[model samples]
Target: MISDEELMALMRYVDGECTDEEATAIRAQLAHDPAYRRAYNEVRQADEALAALPLLEPSTGFNFRVLNQLKAEPHKAVSPISLRKRLLHISGIAIFLLVLPSVLLLLSSGQNPVLILDGSWLPAVGDRQAQVALGPYLQPLLFVNGLLTLLLFDRGVLQPWFRQRHQPPA
Candidate 1:
């Protein structure tokens, strides 16, 4: 099948000059050929119809109304973190943590493990260690953060020093 460009070229041939080779071929095809004539007529009709359609022109007021509508619209705020993304982040952190010690060990494979301590906390840590060895009281330090938080509520919010401060003291 001939391309659209070839058909358009045939239309130009109808106007006037084309290469002798193209002209001769087109002449042979168009002569005594009703089908080729009909096809050329159809192409001319389609081309004319396409050229005759009205072109669009935007109204003078279209720009200002659109911009005003945009300004009147409330801006939407979207959360940066989703539950699935948060879970994926936590999983990535876990994977990093699980591999981190092994990676560090591999990097420092030639070095020996050494004790790490702060000089100021040595006495306090020793006192706690001695308490843990002796009594159940020292178990709180292992999980004192949560316990202390709840204990503060008990000591401050729930506990009553006078039992009736709202009423005049007897």
Candidate 2:
């Protein structure tokens, strides 16, 4: 049995890929070794068979047809506007579901609300003497809400407007 290296050398020789020195060594081996000669003959016959097959040519308009088919397919990319609108809706729902109820609860508590910080300047609600003590949370909650509102506005409204303004006429 011929080794894999010997078979590869025979294939390389058949393909004219072997160096002159390597080809000479393979030729000597083929003359002396019957197994080497048989492998070389098989490799050469397969190579000639492949070379004898006719080359295939595409029909006319093949490229155009492929391009047209590609264009006909709907694009799979998600639109930025739709994504922004979705985010805006989700944020709005979150604020309504989470923040609004807390604010309402705080307001409806009616008992003289404890003020953690000085709220003397705050006006009384109805006949109450003091303001609702929103504790240390009110300022931060309002600030976060303001920031979220700005972010939603930028993403939902300003970004799309700016993109439209900057886009080349197309």
Which candidate's lDDT is highest? 2
Off by over 4 Å in 2: 1-32, 52-54, 72-97, 115-132, 135-147, 153-170
* Residue 26 lDDT, candidate 2, scale 0-100: 93
Taking the tens digit of each residue's C-alpha lDDT, what string does model 2 give over 1-170?
Answer: 89888888888889899899999999898889998888888998999999999999887699778866773544448789898786875677577558766765765676544664444555554334544556466657766776776677677677877986996653
| Candidate models: Cα lDDT each | 0.58, 0.75
Report the lDDT tens digits of candidate 1 across residue range 1-170: 55677687677776555788888877787786776777777767877887799998778699777866774545545456544554554464555456556545644555443334444568655634221221232234324534544554444444433443564532
Clash count per candidate: 0, 0
| Model 2 RMSD, rounded to 1 decimal | 9.9
Query: Clashing residue pairs, candidate 2?
Result: none
